[model samples]
Target: MNTPHTIVETTLVPHTAFEEATQRLEQCFSYADGASEPICIALVGESRTGKSRALEECFTRHAPIRQPDGLTTPILRVKTPSKPTVKSLAELMLRALADPRAYSGTENAKTSRLLKLMNESGVKMVMIDEFQHFYDKGSHKVMHHVADWLKVLVDDARVALVVAGLPTCRAVIDQNEQLAGRFLSPVFMPRFDWQDTDQREEFIAILGAFQESMGEAFDLPAFTGDEMAFRFYCATGGLIGYLTKFLRQAVWNAIDAKTTTIDLANLLRAHSEAIWAKDGPTGLPSPFDRRFSTAATDDLLARIKRIGIPAEEIRLPRSKAARQTGALGVQAVLTAR
Candidate 1:
């Protein structure tokens, strides 16, 4: 297990889209307190495209700046439950509202209580991440009801809803005309494209900043930002979560080995397990991680390396391999003629 020597400062950077979205959200408040509603903007994208993190930060900034009741509590942290719906969604609002009756009422009562709470709290916007789970209730009836329920609550409270999720989330909301109407803007989170020079530069800067934030215990040296960013691009195709996990794990693995340097070797080893490993450092972790073998992990890593490609992708085999690091735990090299 690798432990990160340095911590990462995730707050300093602001993704462009998130900044724009926040500005639009702030304007939603100018509408009548009870009559104006937020124009729902569906934040759709592939997994790990920086959508969730960006939205969270933007929303937190927009929330009322009041301190929470407890010294430890921070006001304006939006709530997202394991299972979301009209009733459960209501409970989340109640909890956000700190309403004691949050648990006292039946499901409908809870929903009603939350709408009342929303209006009282002046919550102009409600954002739901992982909005796709709404369709997973094992029945379409529940899905439709959840949509209708959201419509009613939003209409009643006159607040905007920002739903962030995979593309499938749009389909769910599309079923509700009113819900779809509320969504005037559809923001898409595209994977970081190395093809764009400007995006690539920003990406590298973020990596450098992350390294600095992690501090000296992190073995990663300050190199030309572009070099570090390009290296990660090859490994992860600029997948945000994958890139984050790989970097953090590389530092952690370096720490575990009592090493003071994070090089290609350490990065590759950590990258393999932290991302493609069944344990999945960040993504929906594979259940098999706890029971799988190194070979299984290797296969998964290779497969990820194979996506969007046919059987033609070259695999660097062990027989022609140059060397291996035991703690890094994986080794493969592309062959030269």
Candidate 2:
């Protein structure tokens, strides 16, 4: 029997966007095998759009194997370190390859070792997550050397490369012409938009799937009914991550209360504690509140759209005076030296 806790924690409902992304990743893996030139792809999305999950799903499909001589990793996945430099990025790849001297080698040494290991381990595809780290948020500059190094590494290794990150990470590729040319059409995982008819129906169906899962464990209300589904969409801003979080919290609440069923009250409690606590105040009424209006007003929709989207990139001032001032600072330091 599926317990509420287990069902909520372990279930991964595959939605349309997630399925499409995973399929593309699998295609990339197959195309890279024995290909004359390396295949490269970029997976870009906002946080919680299931980018990492899709990468993970594809990685599981190409699980590493152990032979008498050593381990053979078909796919190597590494997270890009924050504010990555070539040295740091190389070290990370080395560590993923299980190099004992991952931290000790010089950048060039590490790169050589990394390539050798990839060949020995039979690495066909490399998956890099958090690729936005290649673009420094503070300085608004792409780490060109790191991007260049990665491009060369994939080319030399003759392996497919899949880099997944926030939408801002696109700057890393856009700024590097060589890197840009090597990539396929980028795969995008976007949040579910309630305004779109197809997306709205898909979101409702996703809710129905969750409700069915929960129903197996406990008595569940008609969570997929029109009003309830709309409420859930409002609460989660149509992001599957937020919906899962909200549902998990509600399940936990039910278990804590020694209840065998979930109701709107449980959802209301979950909304107040789980969604608002992490996302901050949205000035909107609780979607689960019985008295709350379910009408989809334009004003309401506009505010909901901002729920899970990341803040806009910081725009650094670009002016002749600013450049001159920066140059003067560098010149003053150089003169002091």
Top-scoring candidate (lDDT)? 2
Q: List the residue pairs that clash in candidate 1.
A: 2-252, 3-252, 6-214, 7-214
Per-model TM-score on C-alpha atoms: 0.69, 0.89
lDDT string for model 1 (202-251, tens) is 67766666666655555555633554455555556556666676666776
* Residue 218's lDDT in candidate 1: 51
Which RMSD does model 1 reach against the true structure? 14.7
In order, candidate lDDTs are 0.60, 0.86
Question: What is the C-alpha local distance difference test score of candidate 1?
Answer: 0.60
Summarize candidate 2's per-residue lDDT along 183-266 as a digit string, tens digits. Answer: 889999888887899999888988888888888877888977888888988888777778888889988888999988888888
Model 1: residues with Cα > 4 Å off, grouped in runs: 1-6, 9-11, 29-35, 62-83, 137-142, 215-228, 255-259, 278-337
Instruction: Please give the lDDT score at residue 329 for candidate 1.
Output: 44
Model 2 Cα shift for residue 81 (angstroms): 1.4
